[model samples]
Target: MQIFRQKHLEAVYRRAAEMGPDVARSVELQMLITPKAMGIFKPGIEVIAPVLSTSRKEAKEAVRFIDDSPIRHLASITTPLIPMRTSHMSLVANVTHFPPDVRWCTDNIWIDAPVNNVLPGLKHIADTMPPAPNHSLRLNWQPAASRPDMAFSLESNNYLAVYGAWTRPKYDHKYENWAT
Candidate 1:
């Protein structure tokens, strides 16, 4: 079984290589094989237990934090398994762990990815988005801790952020035909 799984993964890597180096070079592909294949596992199984006492003020404070977090976004989905840090932490060392590169065309492959992935930035944007009231959240601080001090310094030096603007592009009426 183990050998079959390994061969299957290798075939995937070979296919990815045929598409181009970008797919083969992705961090997700690199961590194909390892004991902790998926990522870090947090064991937190909730069960019936005695209720703990809490003050109204404390509860309100907790609520405030909850109202300002990413957990609210996760609750909208069925199963949420977010990783703290992927390649940065070397969680998946071998690039072959990622899906096989299946090319659809010369310019773009079915699973083409940028040589240097920007998924971390995309995830950061999602986490930083303001949460709605009465929603729950869980802040993952691992990335913050590992980030370089220069990143913080840059905020004061050359800060860059979007404000009072729509993150998405305006809808085009010309695409109405495609909606059908």
Candidate 2:
């Protein structure tokens, strides 16, 4: 169990490094030092969750105070509004990292395993993050006219007349039967 926890923690740090410095620090401080660090020792909920922060100072301090600094060099990098990559298949959503921006791509992403043993060449590419806001949440726009035409409406020659024909005539008693 101890060995496994160590391994999982390492992997989490490795993934943070891949996301870029600010992202890595944010993750380490918010998720690693706060929740996952305790989870490693507690029963259940041993998986690491995503790191989230509205402020940069708290993120920096939390990471700095943590016992083990997996990727301390990441603090020197600048932060961007968007994530480095649009598609980080190696990252998993909400599990490995947080605020939905740092997604967890790999399995067992919650465990605190060292990235060296878990991910291939993760250390080499730790700083090679693609970009921020890796994903776009654009609303799907479709022209109203593009909708498929209704078959019933298209087949009817005189829909308006047919609708009125269903009604009975007021004055003609003989035409009552014709209405039916």
Candidate 3:
């Protein structure tokens, strides 16, 4: 029992020692990107969550004291805004590293996943994602009018293979009806 207690205490001490250096490094990195350091007066929520400050010093200190960074370096430094469709949006996105419990409504989605381990990839996820029973979002696939023929033959056996599909209405689970 004493040995177990000592082992736990040693582990806790080791972790605390490790965290001190890491936190200092994080604070130093924060200093580099601070509004005062960058001479940025404009309200930019891109780095840290926007805090209203009268002076640069306050902004710097506020930034240095930030305990967590849900927003990553990718969205902050370069290509500040990469616009997406209005229907879906997520601020804190680590697509590769999803939360333990990531649930997707699939009333509209006809395909049932065999198991959780054999889940869909980014491309397959769209097919599995549920659309509204009434309002089914569709991406019409018509070749560009300007460049109808760049170099490829527009001949295919499948309708969807050549031309994009018009989305059908989703299924309503509550009503047990296919909404139009």
> What TM-score would you give candidate 1 relative to the actual structure?
0.18
Write one digit per residue (lDDT tens) for candidate 1, span 1-180.
011122233332233233322221111212112222122211111110111124544433422322333333322112222223435334332232222231111111122333234234323433333211101111111122244667443211111121111112332222212111
User: After superposition, which runs of candidate 1 have C-alpha atoms over 4 Å from their true positions?
Assistant: 1-4, 24-28, 34-83, 86-180
lDDT of 2 at 5: 34
RMSD of 1: 21.3
Local distance difference test, per candidate? 0.23, 0.28, 0.25
- Model 1: number of clashes? 9
Full candidate order by lDDT, most accurate first: 2, 3, 1
| Per-residue lDDT of candidate 3, residues 46-69 (tens digit) | 121233355656545544423333
- Residue pairs that clash (backbone atoms under 3 angstroms), model 1: 16-101, 29-95, 29-96, 29-98, 30-94, 30-95, 31-92, 31-94, 32-97
After superposition, candidate 3 runs with Cα above 4 Å error: 1-47, 66-180
Clashes of each: 9, 33, 0
Q: Give the TM-score of candidate 3.
A: 0.17
Q: Candidate 2: where are CA atoms >4 Å away?
A: 1-63, 66-109, 121-132, 135-180
Q: Native-vs-model 1 lDDT?
A: 0.23
